[model samples]
Target: MRRLKAESIFTPKGNSVNEKMYVPRSELETAFIKALRKPKHIIVHGESGCGKTWLYKKILAERKIKYEVLNAATVNTAGSISNAIRALTARLTPFETKSYEERKGATASVGVAKGDLQHTRKYDALPLEPYLELIRILYRNAGANDSFLVIENLEHIVKDEKLVRELSSILMYLDDSEYAKYKIRIILVGTTSNLRDYFSKIDSSQTIINRTQEIPEVSVLLSADAKALVKRGFFDLLKAKCLVDPAKGFDEGYLLNAISWFSANVPQYIHELCLELALEIEANNYIITNELYTQCLRNWVQEALVSENTRMEAHLNSKATKHARRNQVIFTIGLISSNEFSAQEVEDSLRNRFPDSTYGKTLNIPAILNELASGNSPLIRKTPKGTRFRFLDPKIKIMARWILVKDEGKDTITVKKFDESIKF
Candidate 1:
């Protein structure tokens, strides 16, 4: 085995993290493991970058179960679905390795091909029947052993009624077929709510939903778990040797908590923040102080804010001006509020910012807040403690600050200066 590099240990923007730095959440992992024991269709849905794929892949590998992954995002048409199935079927076939002399002899005889040796690659699109047959063959080859088929990013094609109905029909058939006998398990991973929307076009959607085991929404890591992850990445995996003086109010525990808190207990954000800090430390001759960490974190927040603003701008259309303004309301609320704030407080703040003439008189503050809290990429969410709401991620606050500064003027305080003024 090869040694791991410190630089590669923490992947901020990458989808998959190194296994050594993986922090397992017992609740989610246990639920997934239980689902894997039997032949049940599993729907794993969660926010993006919440480690749904990582957890599934890790558990499947640990269990030593044979599995094939198909990306549903690319399977938009019947032919594409058939191609995906064909690829999975190919994985079940065994390949034989020949000795060097035998390989050389075969290569030398390639020019003198017999009638039986002549072969042509098939280009004709396969119909639904052949696709179903291929699925049956795949399950049949599994024999007594159990296998997993993970369909990832299903939300991409969930809106196509034709594709959705066909996929549901196929899954329903394989699930109830006597030939399968529960030997092959199917897992659909997406960001959608339930299979409700995907299977809405099909009549047998009820049966499909009943047969499937839907896992609870994958949530961000707990504060304790997030801290442990930081420790593992910094001390164990990367073996970070940066030392900060105790007089400067920096230590392992404080640093861990700071990272966890600022990241809003999200695993991906934690990695991102830590990765930036690590790079800064390495560049500074392996010395890190509380001030350095804060500076790096502020820089990370500014970069994230710019990226998010750009994304929103790219997504906005000519008619989305009002929508953009409403988003600014949500962003402003997130920026000033601490962890949690009441709806009344948010409304009051909005009114104060955009007085009666502009938005105060007409804006339905509560409705806008509710919509923001409930949307697909929710920036604010209601807390368990009564009617108060808070930003789902700390990074949202930074974005909100960026919006505020941009709206004011170029002469307004920059993100770095603003972050410094605030005592995080």
Candidate 2:
């Protein structure tokens, strides 16, 4: 290479990397489309960087459909529903009001701003029925075939029980309203915890739960898919431009071995791991040999450790809080170490340790487990039940045991070994 271009190498550039990136399985999109075409409601949960949002966007773009997208982060209060309604209504229908007509009629309608005819309380207030009517009128004006409303990151609503209850009730009401009969569908995308936590609080959610389609279980990428991911990122993107050529030749077999150790067969990680490799090559000019990968991984872990330590220090420095976060820190580390505990088991351990603590009080311990599990560090994995908790990397697990021995701590049993020794 003549010279490394940081902009071209580090940041994805040219010809749209999206074309090269692996598309997530279509089962989720198929189900979502089916739900939209029919009366089905939907909830999709995906980990950070899982491309769930991207997939949703693709479906919206490719399908012959009309839809509205709302970022749940923006919905802070009941009043904010106005914006959600406007977005949804605009998608359902486009409007063209004559300025001259509005000017002529402006004096007759006092208090209503000349350009803000839709700002009436009738549409803004709670039952949300009038808003649906506005959507219908706009749909007619726009000549949209139908309307679909997508709410992203619903964890915001789920965090507040009252808000979740209100949203749930609104959805249920809309489902049956004549206004929604053929022209409307609602899709909710949020963390799994948000769904379960809100539903667990209110008995009425059972109806909503039954009506909605669940995200199809994301399976580990087959060996072929994994290889494709690597080939696209390294051979096609990097090697084509001689950006970060591997010494071992960026072969499919090497990529397969590297990703097989990941917790989930998440397709998105392929992009991230490639990014890490690019950064490493730029910083150290290390050829992408197998040994170089090992070194890169070590550096990645150390960086994660330093970041975690900094976060812990910040929490400790924030002394205004009533609760001491030391227990949480210890619990997080222990949970990471004892990778064998189920969500329930982890909660039970925490409860036993601190009877007064209320962090894990909910039956939705699985959600808590998930939050703990997906770390930037590779020191966690999901159990069979899809609960997240800490577990050491294979090498780190061994080192932990050795440290326990050096410190004279009690019982450094390896759960995998212990399980194997038990009789069936």
Per TM-score, the best of the predicted structures is: 1
lDDT for model 1: 0.65
Clashing pairs in 1: none
What TM-score quantifies how close candidate 1 is to the native fold?
A: 0.66
lDDT scores in order: 0.65, 0.50
- Looking at candidate 1, what is the lDDT of residue 229? 86
Task: List where candidate 2 sits over 4 angstroms from the true fold.
Answer: 1-17, 24-26, 77-134, 137-142, 193-197, 218-224, 240-252, 259-264, 279-287, 290-424
Query: lDDT of model 1 at residue 176?
Result: 59
Per-residue lDDT of candidate 2, residues 1-424 (tens digit): 5444433533222222364464567787687667666666667765544456666666766775566677777778434555566555555446633122212222335665455332222233344454566556646643766766678877677767767766776577556656565466667886443354456578787777766666653333555666666665555556522323366555446544554333133454444445666566654553455555555544543442334443323222133333333323333344232324576675566555445554445535565445445555433456434444434333333222211111123211222121121110
Q: How do all models score by TM-score?
A: 0.66, 0.56
lDDT of 1 by residue, 329-391 (tens): 654574462456776777677666545334525666677777767745666676534377766
Lowest-scoring 10 consecutive residues by lDDT in candidate 1? 97-106
Per the 3 Å backbone cut-off, how many clashing residue pairs does candidate 2 have? 3
